[model samples]
Target: MKPALKHFFDSMGAYFGRPGEESLEQLYAEHPGWDAQRGRVAVYGDFVRGHVRGVLEKIFPLVRGAVGPEAWSALVEGYTLTRPARHHELNHLAESFPAFVADAAASRGLAAFVPALARFEWTDFAVFASEERAPERVERLTANPTLAVLEHPFQLCAYVRTKGARAEPEAGEELALLWRHPELLVTYYVEATPSALLVLKMAVEGLAVPEVAAATGMPEAELRGAVERYSRDGLVLAPGGGHG
Candidate 1:
């Protein structure tokens, strides 16, 4: 009835379940209330949470697979509590949960791999959630890891691979990609450090095989082979990418 009460109830919807139908009617004197049905005050409420959880389940399958069911639910609950998604799209709802894993790792730092692993998974997701891709010179073949040559906003999706003497992937950490357009896809491409550079080349710098190989220290033959593999997979494409 009043703005204050309405606001309070709205906040309650987010925190508690929707006001119980009884409480809803009793408080607002409405004929009926959402409480009678389900009460998930999530940003997406019930169905959306299911959608997001499904997304998370798919994207973080290894996380679920590794952590197991009970632990997976705990991770999801903790994620929901600490980080309420701000994104309007259910597609991107799990965006920052990787950081959540990183934070959790702070205590034990034991499962350090979980951080990059989670983030790697998120990349594929961002690619799929983002709008259509622009033309890149997809019609070329090279081992250039950087030549992935995507357009901005779609470029590497804000994650980059780190290298050099100072940068080394810990045993637990992994590099991954997340993508979902026509279908949801997440991949864990295990490769030697140099091979991993091939992935970084395409994802981070958008370089084609030759260009990527030139930039990276990996041998030309190896780089070329890697690019061939990636390009064939649709992960790496002709220079003119995503555009008709």
Candidate 2:
């Protein structure tokens, strides 16, 4: 494409989400062809914006629903203006939405619950789309290798699992474990206790069972049982010849 045409299209894409009268005037001034086609350009802008909104709705249904239509529309518009889609793949577009919402919440003086909910929704979305990897025998525990751990001030996992019906926000720390089930080919979430969280953290840090016990003051027998259960449940890969 010609440089002028390319710039016009790029600016048009951005305008779809954040249309300003000045921008429209500038666009027409630069590209006289668009002046005659202002109506068409407006329609196209709305079309593009609608497509983006649809994709975000699918990715963050719970959030969209919770915030209501008007607020959600404004949020999407503002997000598009500030954090415009940079990735070609739509799936990657909202990768930073949780943090974006968190920042927006702080700036707007919204409740703390908003960011927590955003994080939980993103966790579910990420877990569902994450690539499935075969467990490889590594010399040591480099990471959890399967699960994604999220800590929130509320029981966000339960809130999301129940579709925000039964679970209410509680004032305390909550740990969520999200992982894909190998056999079932589905993502699952579970609320984990602090002890389980510690063990998993230690494992991810490449600690041995004895080291984990010493660090956490957890009984060796209990640690062994936890490790065995995690291995069996596919939270971690089956034990290799290296450190547990």
Candidate 3:
């Protein structure tokens, strides 16, 4: 694309926020010969915003419900203005929405709970969409790619499970485990105990079973059982037929 055309599109992307009619008029004046019908531009802008909102709604329904429509719309609009979707796949657009919410909450003085809610929702979405692979044995486990662990001040997983009944932010360390079920073909979430969280962290860090056992001070047999259980449950990859 020519520099002029690139600039035009970038300028148009600004409309994804709250750009006024004057901005559109100015853009039309600056880029004459380009199709800039006000109605058409408005429709285009609505389409883009609607698409982005739909994706975010799917990924963060609880957040949307908690924030209400107006606030959610503003959040989405701000997100488009600041972090426009640059990926070829639209589904990947809201991958960073949780972080964006955190920043927005801080800057706007909105609810302190929104960020952790967003993170919990994004983790579920991410783990569901992540690619699945054959389980590898503990020693050969290089990466626990299919699972995600999120730590938050609010009990986000529990709150979400209760459909966001508790609106006020709670003060506590919450470890959320989002994973794809081994054979059910669906994603699931659970609150993790500290020991369970430690095991998962070790797995994600590519530690061997013995190494994990040593680090956690867990009995070797119990650690091996947990690893095997996760592998069978499809949360962890099966071991490859090789010594690590």
Using lDDT as the measure, the top candidate is: 3
Q: Pick out the ten consecutive residues of candidate 2 with the lowest summed lDDT.
A: 235-244
Backbone clash total for model 2 is: 0
TM-score of each: 0.52, 0.72, 0.76
Best by TM-score: 3
Residue lDDT tens for model 1, 22-72: 533443343245454333333335554465577688776655654557767
- Cα deviation at 191, candidate 1, in Å, is 4.1
Number of colliding residue pairs in each model: 33, 0, 7
| Residue 137 C-alpha lDDT in model 3 | 45
Misplaced by over 4 Å in model 2 are: 1-6, 19-26, 34-43, 106-109, 136-146, 166-168, 198-225, 239-244
Full ranking by TM-score: 3, 2, 1
